[model samples]
Target: MLLKAKYKKNIFFFFKSLLISMQNFLKQFKPKKYKAYNKYVIVSAVYNVEKYLDDFFKSIINQRLDFKSNIYLICVDDGSTDNSANIIKKYQKKYPKNITYLYKENGGQASSRNLGLKYLKENDLNIFWVTFTDPDDFLDRDYFYEVDSFLKKQNNIAMVATNIIFY
Candidate 1:
């Protein structure tokens, strides 16, 4: 009986030590808590949509969200022969802090967008969400507001998409 009690006590101590070591090992992999940043980044590839540029810029500026601070517009001009680059420059001048314009050779839409992503990576801002738009496409006034609401409710969402209204 004495030997059995000693064996049980040794097993208990062994398990306790093992649990402590396991917890210490797992602590190294624990995810660090990050503060929530609600900044929205919009990247647009402009080729030759000068006609629709005004509407696109206006729609983004008139969003119901904090357009002045929380919203960022990245306009990538993919060698547009039209006045698209000028329009982008105008918006960039008007809202220098919120709008960024980048010029590149006549690359495809994907390449232009990739440049925008590269800019995001280089800057390394604490952006909560990143989205894409087109120069000829416009968004509703409450679009960002609605997206923010939905994202706030769902904690595990990796991406969120909205319906497109084709006219």
Candidate 2:
């Protein structure tokens, strides 16, 4: 009985040490930042915009493009105390491949945008163009498609801005 108990204790300690080492090893691949593998990445920062998320997300999801895979959306939530996070999560679930969500402590919009840019830089996304929008804003259905077409045709253009129609 004494020998059995001693062997059991030894085995338990060995497994505990193994588990700790394994956890540390796995932390290396925990994704320091998200990878953007698309041609155009749209980064939007949100804070407690649950009321407007639906419209914002609808505009994004309804974008018309011949090559739909070229566009990506990155939404960063800056410590929203409302249901904004949940709304973003719902959209993420619906468009897992197109949308990337980042959650951070309450910093202002600039900080959130910086985090998005950091993610793109750290992950080496190599995207051709980037854009930003407010969570309460609307995007036209041909937004990405038009932008892609225009950029492809213009060689000297560094950036493009569209006219906004406010309600």
Candidate 3:
């Protein structure tokens, strides 16, 4: 009986040491964790809205948040006959890092938005949130800043809506 008890204690210690060493060995092969920047992607289905395109782009560009790093704008043009595409191209040239311009045959707003989502998935951007906007709709200067603040506080939320002020 004494011999059996001693052997059991030795086996227990042996397994414990083995488990610790295995854990340490596994840690080395673990995936290296790099700091991730949570970015917000805004998708806008743009049709022929040449008149309002400047205002829309200005509102987005003038947001208080760091436009270059914090926010990304995906503008999906739905075959605009007007000079809307030209305006988008202009802005794209000016802010190439912050804006992504996609041209697709006219299929309505929903399809354009879906294409924007597909682009997001294909690129695999580190996105924390996604929201849709209209080409004619302009945002307040502090819009993205406020949204970012609220999002940081309420990470559990899936959706957020802002009061729209029709001018």
Candidate 4:
């Protein structure tokens, strides 16, 4: 229990920094429209992850590609005792077409991710590549562009880890 709480706190801190940084970065951003949702984004959030949502949203909105529909947003609320579910629902209503919000029983992060995957598979969403983002992590707008381009150039690649700045 102690380790879990510690990790969650660290994750929360990292997530908070990400949001603040994104807010700062968002003061100057331009969208580049794309054809469709090119990559699948798996963002798993649980109780006490509220600190990171702002940064996650900011990072996503500032993505270089213009077409917001092309990127799938899978936000799973793992039976949050807090207002996590309500928060996710708010975003879902805001993005009824592009985002998916799942509220499952109080499970851990892994279970929540599995549920998100189940939703994807059930809905028959064909994803060429997949990546994960923590509720408290921030992403660079250019990160997707660089990764997608690199993957396309190198066909045999399966999975890769780029970078993350933890608190």
In model 1, where do residues sit more than 4 Å from their true spots?
1-37
Global Cα lDDT for candidate 3: 0.84
Q: What C-alpha lDDT values do all the predictions have? A: 0.86, 0.81, 0.84, 0.72
> Each prediction's Cα RMSD?
19.1, 13.8, 18.0, 14.5
> Candidate 1 clashing pairs?
none
Query: Relative to the unseen true structure, what is the C-alpha lDDT of residue 115 in candidate 3, on a scale of 0 to 100?
Result: 100
TM-score winner: 1
Candidate 3 regions with alpha-carbon error over 4 angstroms: 1-38
Write the residue-wise lDDT of candidate 1 on 29-79 in tens digits: 964322223779999998999999999999998887768877999999999
The positional error of residue 13 in candidate 1, measured at the CA in angstroms, is: 94
The candidate 3 region of ten consecutive residues with least summed lDDT is: 30-39
**Rank ordering of all candidates by TM-score, starting from the highest:** 1, 3, 4, 2
Candidate number with the higher TM-score (2 or 4) = 4
TM-score, candidate 1, is 0.77
Give the TM-score of each candidate: 0.77, 0.73, 0.75, 0.73
Better of 3 and 4 by lDDT: 3
lDDT of 4: 0.72
The true-versus-predicted C-alpha distance at residue 2 of model 4, in Å, is 68
* TM-score between model 2 and native: 0.73
In the range 2-61, model 2's lDDT, one tens digit per residue, is 345654768886667679999999999853322222378888999999999999988876
Tell how far residue 123 is off in model 1, in angstroms. 1.1
Lowest summed lDDT across 10 adjacent residues in model 1 is found at 30-39
